[model samples]
Target: MGMEIPDPISIESVGTWSDEVDVVVIGAGMAGVSAALEARASGASVLVLDSGGRLTCTSAMAGGHFYLGGGTEVQQATGWDDSPEAMADYLGLMSPECDPAKISAYAEDGVEHFRWLESLGFEFNRSFYPEKAVVQPGVEGLSFTGNEKCLDVAEVVKPTPRGHKVPVPGDTGGAGLVVGLALDKLDALGVEVRWETGATAMVVDGDQVVGVTWKNYDHTGAIRARSVIVAAGGFVLNRAMLEEHAPDLLAVESNGMALGNTHDDGLGIRMGQSVGGVADYLDKVFVTGPFYPPGEALRGIVVNKLGKRFVNEDSYHSRTSAFVFEQPDREGYLILDSATMVQPSYRFQPLVDGWDTIEEMEQGLGIPAGALAETMAAYDEAAARGEDPEFHKAPEYLVPLDQGPWGAYDLTPGKCFYAGFSCGGLRVTVDGQLLRADGSVVRGVYAAGACASNIAVDGKGYASGIQLGEASYFGRRAGRRATAEVAQR
Candidate 1:
């Protein structure tokens, strides 16, 4: 089964009302914390329910890069010239189905949101790196986390540094954000936080969700509320959901690990769906990492089992990993010579199957006749001339692979070290309202973060920090909206 939704019980069956609040937030990750904080600030009584006893989920394990820009204070402080238009255009071009209004607002109001994060003591060192890597190694807080520098990516919108690397003295990125918000915002603000329990079902009054079914003390009493925010995360942790939704991930054996803890089950998404909420991109996931490094790896070549290059090897690691899964026999080889392979990226091993010549390495790897040679010959000719006519890797990385002693490293999934999480979940509008297939809203209910399917989609489209960035940002929006809706009623 994908996700089982519990049947709603009678609101009057519990004998007496255990408690009441203006808003009840499910899960205690970044999204739930943001919601509880915003709703309380809006003068509504907020109750946060967490499956885990503490605020330690996938968000706490993140690398801490929040993709924030569009003339943000850090961007301005670092002397980067960027605007909402560029950000919006880039995002719009990449995420074709994203609501235009939401995209526009996300770009336009990004700075205010950045300040909101900063106000929470989420510190960032203001410096920019124009390199091609998954996460910047040093503590410097900014980099081009997207495909902005790629030829095709550059054509849509001018590239700008947007990765907001949160500076942690010695903390993990997601943990820092979750801890700062939990301690300063949620705990200090006195939002009612309940742990070891979470919402099992939605108590509906006709069209609107009026309460949640959860254990109050020992009894499964329903907690009445004017609104509920489902931030319980994606279904990545559920093996059944993976088989039904994204079996491609499961087929890879022990290769990729899901993002969050077991509490990341899609219980919240099912709760929304039981009430007519809709979801999209359920088949999509973020397959990433084992990014071949040494920076000059871009100068080398990647060929499938057929020994032919499929994608621009210089793109993001997610993109590289994404295409590798599609190759015949699910095999690919990274051809590198002695000079280019000097500093082997410890990310993956076997050090590219060393040989004295390209042909010898090609034969040893069992590549198709003449395919690897032709591929290498073209790449060599291009690099010697300071250009890649086929893939368009930058000239700066266009060094010749002529010094002999060539080899091939396997890029097959399950064989390479990889880690990721699900990106698809319940579909929501910019305001965080869960939407039905007919475009009607699931009133008094909202979702954000990994559960919302707003920002991160496939690995190819992801920029580091986007999941955390949009989760916290939209969680605030959802909170204010849910409270304001109750006030109007």
Candidate 2:
């Protein structure tokens, strides 16, 4: 008699054979959700799983800005002229080492992805500018084609105001909106969702990936699939992974809360590695510096080990802040005052997670007793005389740090609580195919979002929500491609 195929596995098959599907998505963040929705839309059965108790991950905690050009409906109505070439040029300038071809593909198809999202009940504010427009200031330059002034037709890009923010209040609005919309769509499309399900490994049959072995809060099991999409996010929270992947960023306190839930620990990347998937962008990880504790906010200046300011603080906002962790001494401090911290003039808050009193904060951050006073006196003296004696910070951005019992946080050049460390990840083609170590495509596997290598376009983390945009774009592309492949087979 022929070998038995075994009865169809049930959903409760923990540590045993489980039911199968057309596709198994390893994350539920923007990329995973997008992949599931697209795969289902393309008529393939999909099972999207996440280790987080909740459905959303750091993606829900993002600023929610999607980069697009070619005069979106809102841009066109507002008379803002933007094109694919212009957007690509801006990305090239931001990341000169990036593959122009991939960046160009992102720019060219980003509009369509935005429109696709709109079709899925996702609403955009259409702010009439790019989110990280500051990457491309007022200047006419050549396009990726080396044609001088070819992108002159595009409008000026600002650091802010290029992308739309989620109308919902608070930081999570964007992530909530996108993930909510995608989840609703997936539900309507009948896609299966298994939350609190941690993927432990990929089950490969020869050269083909057959499925994934996952451990849920209840038990462990496996879900077979024709293809797998690894959207499990980057390794910002895995201290060991951070040390291994980016040792320079181990000291900074990561803005993990800023990204929402902290389950984005590169589980998918690790699992992919187990199944012969080669991880890329390990050396291209980004680093961030520490923000001034309560009283500095965006007005504070970050000084290096020698007590000197190093970068255009205003320009490098969130992305390059990781670099502070790479300092030789990995020690630096932010100089600011109580007035600035209390009021706040920029996007970042002076006191992260709220500690009210300097004493309380000092207790947690371990600042020397008198150091706060000395730093304050120095900053106050400079601010009172219309100068930054220590760091030469711009007068407008300078706020005196002379309030009672000033606060200081002993910060190293490691990942900050407000910033993550994984910047570059697995490299992928514009079409979302995971690449091999030799820069070739890995069949039956794809990557999207921060988990994939992104330094090609966003070398410095230009804005808050651009990465999510790329995630959504590539996630959808991967979903569609996987669906097509399954259908053909």
By lDDT, the best candidate is 1
- Model 1 C-alpha lDDT per residue in residues 108-210, reported as the tens digit of each score: 8888888877778756777776666566677777888777777777766787888887775332564455455665667777887888886788887778888
How high is the lDDT of residue 488 in model 1?
Answer: 93
lDDT (0 to 1) per candidate: 0.78, 0.60
Task: Specify the highest-TM-score model's number.
Answer: 1
| Candidate 2 residue runs with Cα over 4 Å from true position | 1-17, 126-161, 253-262, 283-309, 326-328, 331-418, 455-461
What TM-score quantifies how close candidate 1 is to the native fold?
A: 0.95
TM-score of each: 0.95, 0.72
In model 1, what lDDT does residue 72 have?
A: 85
Candidate 1 global CA lDDT score: 0.78
Q: Report RMSD (Å) for each prediction in the order shown.
A: 2.0, 9.1
